[model samples]
Target: MMRHLRSIMRITWVDKVPSKEVLERTGLPSMEDLLTRKNLRWTGHLMRMSPNRLPNKSIYSQMPSVHRKRGRPRLRFKDTIKRNQKLRDIKTHSLASLSQQRDKWREIVK
Candidate 1:
C-alpha cells in the first residue's frame, strides 16, 4: 500500500547524517566546538582515520552481560565460605609453589 511505502521511506530518511550547513543553521556546534584544542585535533585525526558511524542503541542492548546481579542469596555467608575454601586450596597448591620458586631465585641471585 502507499501508506506502508511512505512509512518505510520516512524511517530511511531518519538515519541520514545532517550536513554542516544544517548544523550551523540550527545554531548547534560540532563536536569539535565542545572539546579542547588538543582533544579536537585528536578527535579529527581519529575521525579521518576511521570515519565509521556508531552502532544504534538496540545493537548495544543486545550485547551479552559481562556481570550479573543474582541478589542477596549469592552474597550470603555460605557462599563466602565456599569462596574462601577455593581460595585456600589455590594458595596451598599454586601460590605456595610460586612463593618457594621466588625464594629460590632470590637465594641464587644473592
Candidate 2:
C-alpha cells in the first residue's frame, strides 16, 4: 500500500503582481483568467526601498532662527489713511428702505 504526501512553498515579497502591459506582452489571457488557473501563484506583499534617515545633529542644526523672516513679507499700502477717510465721508442709509422700494416697483409692473 502507498500513502499521499503534501508539501508547502514559501513566497517572497520580491515577486510582484503582473501589470496589464506585461500580460499583453506575454500573450496571456485576462488577469481574471490568470488568477483562476490551477498553476498560477502569487506573493501577497510588495517590496519597497528603505527611507533615508537624517542624523539628529543635522536636523537640530538646520532649525530657523526665531528673529529671521520665515516666508514672503506682507504688502504695505501707503494710502490706507486716505482710503479710510474717504470711506468715513460716505453717507450711511438703511438697506431695508431700498428693498421696500424695489418690491413696490415690481408689484406695480406685475
Q: Pick the candidate with the highest lDDT.
A: 1
Spell out the clash pairs found in candidate 2: none
Question: How would you encode candidate 2's per-residue C-alpha lDDT over 55-86 as one tens digit per residue?
Answer: 32332244364575778654322133223224
| Residues 1-110 of candidate 1: C-alpha lDDT, one tens digit per residue | 32344354453345553445445545655544433333323322332342254422322244465686676534533343334435333342443233345454233222
Q: What are the lDDT figures for the candidates, one per model?
A: 0.38, 0.30
- Model 2 earns a TM-score of 0.15
Could you estimate the TM-score for every candidate? 0.18, 0.15
Candidate 2: list runs displaced more than 4 Å: 1-18, 34-110
